[model samples]
Target: MTAMSPTPHDPLGAVLPPSPDNELDTLRELVSSTYLNHDPSLVTIRAGALFARLKALNRAANHATRAHKQATADSRQEMDHTYLGLQNLLYEKRHLEREIDKCRQFASVYQDIPVHALEDFMQIAPEEAPLNSPNAKGAPQLDLKRKELIKEKEALLKESKAQLATVENVKTHIDNLMKTATDVRRKVNDLVQPLPTTSEPGQSTPAS
Candidate 1:
C-alpha cells in the first residue's frame, strides 16, 4: 500500500513547503486567488483604514510639535525676561556704585577737618560761588574786620593775664601786710604789759 501525499492545508506540509509538481497549475491558482481578493470595496476599506491611522498619527505628531514649539518659545521668553532683569540690575548696580564713589569722593574732600568742625565749616562756606568770586569786594573789608577782631581778642587776653598777675601780687602784699600788722600788735601788747618789781621783806612804811 502507497502512503497518501500531504494535503495543501496540512501544517507539516506547509512548514516543509511543497515542491512544484506543476508550475502552470501553481500560476493559475495564484491568479485565481489574487482575483478572488480583488474586491474594490475591500481594497477601498483597507486603504481607508490605513489612511485613517496615518492621519491620526500625523495629527498626534502635529499636536506634539506645536506643544514642543510653544514650550520652547515660553522658555525663551522667560530667559529673555530674566536676562533683561539681570541687565537692569547690572545697570542699577553700576549707577549705585558711581553714586557711592561720588559720595566717597565728597567725603574724602572733607576729610581734613575734625568731625566736630564740619558743621561750623558748612555754616561758613555754604556756597562755592561766594568763595570763588573775586567781585565780592566786601570780602576784603570783612577779612580786615576779622583780623582786627582777632587782634582785639589777643590784646584783651594779654591785658586780662596782666591784670590777673597784678591782682595776685596785690593779694600777696595784703596778706603780708596783715601778717606785719598782727606782729606789730603782738609787740605792742608785750611792751604795754608792766614788768613786776619785787620789794624786800621789812619795808612796810611808805604809802604813795
Candidate 2:
C-alpha cells in the first residue's frame, strides 16, 4: 500500500490523525450478537435506544453551531454601531472647533461704544461747530460726520449682540453633542458587560 501525498496548501493533508474505517464494526457485531436474528423484538429495542442517543447528540451539536453564528453576528453589529458613533463624534468636534474660531474672530471685531467722542460732538454748537473747529467752513460736513459716526456705532453694537447670541447657540449645540457621546459610551459599556452565569436547576458543581 502507498501513502497519499500531502497537498501544497495543506502540508499535513489531514488536520487530525486518521480514524479506522471500521471503528464501529465491533460495536455493531456486539449488538447483532446480543439481539440474534431470531429475536426481532430485542433488535427493535436496541436499535431504538441507539437511535435516540445519536439523535439527541446531533440536536445538541446543531443548536451549539447556531448559537455560535448568532454570537458572531451580534459582535459584528456592535462593532459597526461603535464605529458609527465615533464618526458622529468626530463630525461634531470639528463643527464645534469651527464655531469657536468664528466666535473668536467676532469677539476681536467687537468694541465698546465711543461715549467720550460722542460727548465731544454734543458739546459743539449746531451751526458754529466747524467755525471754531480746525476745518473752518466745513461745519455742515462736521455735523454730517458726527451723525454718521453715531449710526455706525449703533450698527456695530447691534452686530456684537447678534454675534454673542450666535456664540451662545453654538456652545449649546456642542454641549448637547458632548452629552450624547457620553450617554452612548455609557450604554455601550453597559451592553458589553457579561451577564453572570447560573447553574441549571438540577446541576451540581464537580468536587475537587
Candidate 3:
C-alpha cells in the first residue's frame, strides 16, 4: 500500500493508522529480518565486544545491501544504522554475524572482503577505509621490509664481533714472536765477544 502523502493542511500530517496496507507490512518485513528483530534466545547468549560487533555488522550489512539494491532511492536522513556493519568490516579482520546466517550463511563477509571500489566511489579516505585504501595499501609490505632490515643488522653485528676477536688473537701471537726474536739477538752478541786473558799470556812469553 502506498504511504499517505504528507499534506500542508493536516497539522498532524498524513497520520495514516498502522494498517496492513502500509505500516503493518513494513513492520512484518522488519521483524522477519534478523538484523532488525533478533531472537530472544540468541540475545541471552550475547557476551563481550564480539557479540555487539556482530549485531552491528549484521544491521550495517543489511543497510548497505538494501541501499545498493535501491540505487536510485533517496533514503531518509538520520538513517545511519548502516555504519555499524561498515566500520566493523573496514577495521576488523574477522567477525561472526548471527543475523545474516539464514540467507547468506556468512552475513558479514564484507569484513573479510573489503569493498574498496565502493569506498572509493563514496570518497571515503580514512586510513581504515578498506584494503584498497591508498593509506594502508603499502603498509604491510613496508612492515615486511622493516623486519628484514632488523634481521640483517643483527647478523652484521654478530659478524663484526667475530672479526674483532680474530684481530685480538693475531695481535697476541705477534707480541710473542717479537719477544722470542729479542732473546735470540742478545745471545748471539754474548757468544761473539773476544777473551781478555789471552793478551796477558802472549806478552809474558815474548819477555822470556
Candidate 4:
C-alpha cells in the first residue's frame, strides 16, 4: 500500500504525530457504528427538532427587532413634540419681551407728562353726556336745568327792560309837570304884580 503525501493545505498533518494502529481502529469503529450505521428516522427527527428551534429563535429575533423599531419611532415622535412645544413657548416669551420693551419705551418717552388719579380726574373734568345716549337720565336732567336757567335769565332781562321803560315814562311825565308848574307860577307872579302907573306928560307924586 502506498502512503499518501500530506498536502500543503493540511495544517493539522504538520503539527499532529502519527496515529497508532489502536487509535486508528477506534476511530474507524466509531465512524462505522455511530455515523455510517445511524438510523435515518432518528436523524430526520433530530434535524426537524433543530430546525424548529432555529425558526423559533429567528421569529423571536424578528419580534424583538420590530419592538425596538416601534419604541424608537415613538421616542422620536415624543421628542419632536416636546421640541415644538418648547419652540412655541420660546416664541411667546420673545413676543412678551418685545411688548414689554415697547411699553417701557413709551413710558420713558412720556415720563415727564403728569398723571392723575382716577378720582382726581373725575373731579376736575367737565361732566359730558355719553355720545349717542340722548335718552340717558342724567343727560336729560342737565338739559332741563340748562333750559330752565336760560328761561329764567330771559325772563329777568324782559322784566328789567319793562321796568326801564316804565322808569323812562315816569321821568318824562315828571319833567312835563315841572315845566307846567313853573309856567303857572310865573303867570301868577305877573298877575299879582301891581300895574305900572303912567301919567301922560304929567308928574304925579303918591306917598305909599
Strongest candidate by TM-score: 2
Model 3 error, position 131 (Å): 7.4
Better of 1 and 2 by lDDT: 2
Task: Report the error of model 4 at residue 71, Å.
Answer: 1.0
Clashing pairs in 2: none
Span of 10 residues, lowest total lDDT, candidate 1: 9-18
Better of 1 and 2 by TM-score: 2
Worst 10 residues of 2 by lDDT: 12-21
lDDT of each: 0.46, 0.50, 0.40, 0.46
Off by over 4 Å in 3: 1-132, 195-208
- Cα lDDT tens digits for candidate 1, 26-120: 43454465656677676556555544554444454444445434544554555455455555545554554555455444433323533323335
The residue-by-residue lDDT of candidate 2 on 1-208, one tens digit each, is 1122454322222222222223234337646665465577765675566555544444544444454345445645665665566566567656656755664565422245332344455576486455455655465665676677678867766766665666566566656655655654554444344322323222456999
Pairs clashing in candidate 1? none
Per-model C-alpha RMSD: 59.4, 14.5, 55.7, 65.9
Tens-place lDDT digits, model 3, residues 59-175 = 544443343334212221112333343344433322222222222442332335433343353476655557566856665665566566658756655655555555455455545
Report the lDDT tens digits of candidate 4 across residue range 17-127. 222333334434544657667777775665555445544444544444454345445545554554555555455545545554554444332236444443454566567
Each candidate's number of clashing pairs is 0, 0, 0, 0
lDDT of 4 at 73: 53
Q: How does residue 98 of candidate 1 score in lDDT?
A: 59
